[model samples]
Target: MHASVKMQFDAIANDYDRQRKQLIPCFDEFYGMAVSLVECEPSSKVLDLGSGTGLFAGLVMQKYPDIHLTLMDLSDSMLDGARARFSRTDRVQYIVGDYSEYAFSGQYDAVISSLSIHHLTHPDKQRLFHTVYRLLRSGGIFVNADQVQGHTPAADAYYRKQWLEAIHRSGLTQEAIDSSIERRKLDINATLSDQIGWLEAAGFTDVDCMYKYLDFAVFYGKKA
Candidate 1:
């Protein structure tokens, strides 16, 4: 990713929370759905993938004071925002790199990625799931808050148009929307059910959807 590309997120980082307040209900649902599955305690060591602006990470950090966290992202600018958000917290370790290719070090008690995996190509999402499965200790869990592709043709078209309009209404510029949709080459999104099947195919056990609202969902699976 180009430096400037990451800078786009950095520019919006400070206002990101305020501007995206409209989505708070959705994110709160995401967080609640995630935590219900993987309970955090003092011993939990969490890996937060594509942790933009560190919103979810901040919540986890605050809720579990003793929990250790590894925050990873491909964007330097986003990492900068994450660092500032959790200032004075030695419990967090930061890494700047593409998580899909970068080597994930250390076994995590739980691994979670929020709202970023949809940006990946289908094959990349599979590779990422396999990598996460590998990184987990036996019985450890993996959960993701992600956007799913609708299964039916009609539903897919409906959700696509709805999502685009939601972004437009929420104040994103037309150019940014077009550029982001194009730059990432997000041509097809897999249904939530299909994503869970991939996790099961990766040898993860007990994979299932934790929550769903339209095309947005949180899914979790446990390592055997």
Candidate 2:
């Protein structure tokens, strides 16, 4: 991860919910889809990589209270928010680390991440697949909800305008969208095909793009 982007997230931590409320519907749908994809038994052990504020983890917990989750993130402040959010439960464990390099030795039934990893460079993204694959038990899945690069110029324009309209309708100014575009470079997202290839290379089978809306996408693959 870029030091600058990590710092940006640190600064945005307090205001993130206030500034990005428009992302709720999209995030809600994404998490729902990812959670639906999880093939968990009553005693399944899941790992949520890059878990922020425990929002998705809370949903998963509500749905399957018996399932266990280990949430990991890079920012301590995000971990604090997550700890507070999941305060009622003792089923969750938190870790502060970079998944790009950290080696989690234990096996998990499912691995997940949401709206994270775009900040990571492409190579690191690929390495993440290998890590997830290694961490999962056989037949386990990795579900990731995130942004994607467009397939063509028209698609790029389409997603760009859709995102702009979403932001504008949410009361965020044009300058805010433009600023995010510049600082985050989200529109140039890595292609879905390449990411799928990376997962396959990491020894996953049955890879699929489970859901998508323009730049927003959810994908998962079963580890063999």
lDDT of 1 by residue, 64-89 (tens): 87888899887767777888888887
**Number of colliding residue pairs in each model:** 0, 0
lDDT of 1 at 53: 75
TM-score of each: 0.85, 0.89
Model 2 stretches with alpha carbons more than 4 Å out: 17-21, 172-183, 186-188
Clashing pairs in 1: none
Clashing pairs in 2: none
Give the lowest summed-lDDT range of ten residues in model 1.
179-188
Candidate 1 global CA lDDT score: 0.76
Query: What is the per-residue lDDT of model 2 for residues 96-203, given as tens digits with 9 covering 90 to 100?
Result: 878787867889999988878776788888888888898999989898887888878788788878877777677666765565556565323787788889889999
Indicate which candidate wins on lDDT.
2
